[model samples]
Target: MDHQLTQNLEEYSASSTTIKFDRPIPLLRAPSRPGLPMTLTGPYILAFKDLPSWAAAYKSCESKIIAQCEEGARIGCAITASNKCKPPWWQSLTGWKSMDLKERERCEDREMEDCLVSAKEKCMGFAKEHATTPFLDARIALGEGR
Candidate 1:
């Protein structure tokens, strides 16, 4: 199969015009995630003796980060949506009325910002404790480091 694919690629590259092949060329599919496969590749087996443990830790961090971000988004959406409803009894009794549309939007924006900042802090704390070096390195590369 490898020989046949290489031959097909060579033939395709040599031809200037579109070349119709008798068989479809096979392509390599990337793993769903960016990390190495469950099994280590050649020459790296010694370095990854505990690959499963590392993978689990990486996945745990990933899940926690996703959950935190989702919660933040949920909180922001709830706040923005709640603004459309009437003020609570305590607030109404204290002369705090429901804000106008523009004011409500501003308030929502501020609340969302606060929620995201808190979420980020939580995620960073989790990463510090549970994430693998490579995972943290990647976050740093993406400008999300602590």
Candidate 2:
């Protein structure tokens, strides 16, 4: 939604090729549900019109990761606070003990990293299958040579 993001998407789209696809490619979009954590949203996958759409989708995916991480931090803080006091037996039995603060944070970080990696892989794979030259050239122009 930011101007910079829009500009980046426009630049990437403009620099990328204009190859036509038999069918529109699916690209990932952020979850529509309010307060729905990205972790529960599963993998990054959706539909896109062109390189600009792809760039936008990719940015959305990154935003989702950040949201998930922040949510995890909030949950961790709540758990830590509860642990400081006396939590109910049911709460204690909920398996929160199995994952300490560090472990939980690490798990969330790992999940976010995995999601981003998956998105990058999917993007690259799609470009390779559809318009390798344009995609690569745009990446190079954006100083993201590969």
Candidate 3:
């Protein structure tokens, strides 16, 4: 089956997580980005080794992800109990802020970078640990012809 869809993007910030790099990080010889399906159409590739590591990564980061999402949601909440909301991306943050949009974005980006410094190190550690494991590439051209 041939198909395609736009990738949804979101933004936010929090604490207790960091990933950084002093030099460029290669794609680890993977055909595509890690944990992402090869294409919009068919030809999905999943390696046995990757499955465990993928699950482990998510498991390791799941709580952190949820906590941050909840915090975002709370910030977006309408009530004074916004702290009671689920998360902004999930439910959307509706509160009004007095700061400039560009400045807010810059702040988010800076905070994100700060938190990811350690995360970058962690990813490098994983990539080094799995340096030997192969990541299969699956990409194809479609539509009219080649």
Candidate 1 lDDT tens digits, 5-94: 988777767465576768955322112233454333322221222346446656766778768766766676566656544355688678
Quote each prediction's TM-score: 0.35, 0.26, 0.24
Give the lDDT of residue 45 in candidate 2.
Answer: 25
Instruction: Please name the candidate that would achieve the greatest lDDT relative to the true structure.
Output: 1
Looking at model 2, how many pairs of residues clash?
5
What local lDDT score does residue 24 receive in model 2, on the 0 to 100 scale? Answer: 61
| lDDT (tens digit, per residue) of candidate 3 on 26-108 | 43123333345344434443333345555554454544554555555444332323222223453335564445657655556
Reference-based TM-score, model 1: 0.35
* Cα error of candidate 3 at position 52, Å: 2.4
lDDT of each: 0.55, 0.50, 0.42
Model 1: residues >4 Å from true position, as ranges? 1-86, 90-98, 132-146
- Give the clashing pairs for model 1: none
Candidate numbers, best lDDT first, in rank order: 1, 2, 3
Candidate ordering by TM-score (highest first): 1, 2, 3
